[model samples]
Target: MTVDRRPGGVLELRGVAGGYGGATVVRDLDLTVGSGEALAVLGASGSGKTTVLRMIAGLHPVSAGRILVDGRRVDPLPAQHRGIGLVPQQGALFPHLSVAKNVGFGLVPVDPLARWRSRRERAARVREVLDLVGLADRADDRPSRLSGGQQQRVALARALAPGSGLILLDEPFSALDAALRGRVRAEVSALLAESGATSVLVTHDRA
Candidate 1:
């Protein structure tokens, strides 16, 4: 339940079992992701790939076994407290907020006494992540203004904005066209590699 944070990378699931009430989707599954590694969990529609991702993201309770982050157990932690970034199939962006604000949403408040003081710092972080995802110019743009691929990039930037060491991507590129999917996947893969983030990517298409 208690996981120790390592310098980076390393996500392990041991004998993980879980499902919706009596129905089990994932059973006795074990997996590991090294630092800066990209792992693809390829499966059919009902293969429980997303379920495994949710379990690692702490969205689903593990009925048995342990979930470890960098060699530390995290079974008892909440989703946000687990330091896992999950990018669902849907872009899941806020319609009213600009790209920058949405990406910076994960930033922790500076202080209980003076929250306004961290605005500049937060903005800087947002810009850094936006640029990393090649959307710096769209900081002020709304999600409605961006294309599907662009919106996914914004989502990726938002997930990375928090500096989480591990990321769980569940068919994040499923909405993109074939051409655009290749481009966006390459960009995201490169960015994650450069940032030294260990990621588990779930996809139905083997390609």
Candidate 2:
């Protein structure tokens, strides 16, 4: 795999704090993840790992501090505009759409060139991403027909399709079987490194 020479877009959280109203989960958190690096946030149940991702993804408002992507403040922008790729713990794939459509959903608007604006282009891009996740042949299948691990890969493919500078994964490998988990993890790690993706993973898994 060839690595991108340019910066992967740095992710920095300074003095960050936020949660549901009248509640505080992450407090005064300060972190810096350089281009192409993965930062894992690990904690037990109710320990606020998900909350941190939610806040960063703009799903949950930030009550304090700042989130920066490549030195630009991102809290004011919506999730899609912030150039973020997110894989929630639930592997939130659109049940109605085929795996190919789901993975290609983000690319249509994200790419501006007229040549890339075609549906065929999006489908090709979808195939490329699925191949990376080891689901190239499952493109026509629906999410319901896939195994848990396969579904997770579909969700992951959706996230990766946009080629977002920042990737936020919430227990991304949770649904995978043990043998598949290790292989998937290594593949994902290599993919991110090759593509120069800056990633943050939130997990409660102690192992």
Candidate 3:
């Protein structure tokens, strides 16, 4: 398949073959996520959907082929160097940090004046992303005070705050109540579109 290169297209998997040591789960999976596009990797349980996300996030190694972001081959690069964002199913928020801090955590450890922007700038960016996901008012709240849905939004905001071109979500909304799934999905889709981020969402249901 011909992969289209767009300015913001953040991720491409070509002939990706990967799985646990002895067994292969995904083979020759050719996929491309374009700029601002949200592509769902739909498969049944144990069909290797999550494995694909893990491979993209560098949590798993590729046995063959390549993973590219921004036209650069990233299979050889380390996870942090790939500039990829991941929002796992559990939200994985830091219990000790406030919502704002959790969202801005990825910005920490950068030189204050180097890769880092001003604290106000970072806060503003965090606020902007939180607001996009409808969590601006909860910035000062801890993860413990938020509902599961709210926590999921916070996790998404955190992932987006780093301005990563691509986000890989591994069943991020699975914990929410069925009634809330649609709302969360809609919000996430809109936020990704507005940010011009290419995203890969792994879901079990084919529908």
Model 1 Cα lDDT, one tens digit per residue, 1-207: 111222446989999999896998898888888887889999999888988998888888899899999888998888867777878898899999999989988787534542223778777778878887778899999999999888988888877776788888999998888989988888888877766778899999888
Candidate 3 regions exceeding 4 Å error are 1-7, 109-114
Query: Candidate 1, which ten residues in sequence have the lowest lDDT sum?
Result: 1-10
lDDT of 2: 0.81
Error of 1 at 68 (Å): 0.6
- Per-residue CA lDDT of candidate 2, range 26-112, in tens? 899999999889888999889998999988898988989999988999987887678788988778888999999899888867445
Per residue, candidate 3 scores C-alpha lDDT tens digits across 21-118 of 68999899898777777899888889899999988888889999999987899988767767788999989999999999999998764444433377
Using TM-score as the measure, the top candidate is 1
Clashes per candidate, residues 3 or more apart or on different chains: 1, 0, 0
- The CA lDDT of each predicted structure is 0.83, 0.81, 0.82
Candidate 1 TM-score versus the reference: 0.90
Best candidate, lDDT: 1
